[model samples]
Target: MRVLVQRVRSASVTVDGEVVGEIRPATQGLLALVGVTHEDDATKARRMAEKLWQLRILDDERSASDVSAPILVVSQFTLYANTDKGRRPSWNAAAPGPVAEPLVTEFTDALTALGATVQTGVFGADMQVHLVNDGPVTVLLEL
Candidate 1:
C-alpha cells in the first residue's frame, strides 16, 4: 500500500459533475491518494491509516489525531505506474479493482475508527479533485 498525503486548506472530489466528497479545514487537514499493490492486505491498510491519522504534518507540527482533522481519501491506482521500460506506462504493479477496493475501505475505516472525519471519492470512477494546498506540504508513505 502507498499513500500520498497532502495537507490542504480545502478540497473536493467531483464525479460526473456531482460533488462526492469535500472538506474545509478549520484547522488544516489531509488529502490522501491511496494506492494498492498485489501484496497489500487489511493489515497494511490499517497500519497506513493509523500512520496518516497520526502523522504530524500540519501547522505547528500538529497531527490530524491531535486536532481531529478531516481527511479526504481517494483511490489512485496510477501510483503504481511503471514508466521505466518505454513511452507507455505499465500498471502491472497495481492490484486489480476487486482486490483493491476492500483494502481501500479498510484503510478509510481504520482512519474513521481512529476518530478522524473521513471523506472519500468513488472507487474506479473518473474524478476531478480540487484543493487549496496548505503550506504546499505533501508527504508520501509506503508499506
Candidate 2:
C-alpha cells in the first residue's frame, strides 16, 4: 500500500458533476491519495490509516489526531505507474480494481474507526479532485 498525503486548507471530490465528498476545514485537513498493489491487504490498509491519522505534517507539527482534522481519501491506482518503458507507462504494478477496491474501503473505514471525520470519492469512478494546499506540504508513504 502507498499513500500520498497532502496538507490542504480544503478539498473536495466530484463525480459525474455531483459533489461526492469534501473536507472543508477551518484551517487544515488532509488529502490522502491511496493506492494498492498486489501484495497489499487489509492489514496494510489499517496500518496506513493509522499512519495517516498520526502523521504530523500539519501546522505547528500537529497531527490530525491532535486537532481533529478531517481527511479526504481517494483511490488512485496510478500511484504505482511504472514508467520505465519508453512510450507508455505500465500498469502492472497496480492491483486490479476487484482486489484494490475492497482494501481502499478498508483503509477509509479504518480511518473513520480512529475517530477521524472522513470523506471519499467513488471508487473506479471518474472523479475531479480540487484542493487548496497548505504550505504545499506533501508526503509519500510506501509500506
How many clashes in each structure? 0, 0
Reference-based TM-score, model 1: 0.99
Q: Determine which window of 10 residues in candidate 1 has minimal summed lDDT.
A: 22-31
Candidate 1 per-residue C-alpha lDDT over 1-143 given as tens digits, one digit per residue, 9 for 90 to 100: 99999999999999999999999988788999999999999999999999999899988889999998999999999999999998999999999999999999999999999998999999999999999998899999999
Off by over 4 Å in 1: none
lDDT of 2 by residue, 1-143 (tens): 99999999999999989999999999899999999999999999999999999999988999999999999999999999998979898989999999999999999999999999999999999999999999989999889
39 in model 1: Cα distance from truth in Å?
A: 0.2
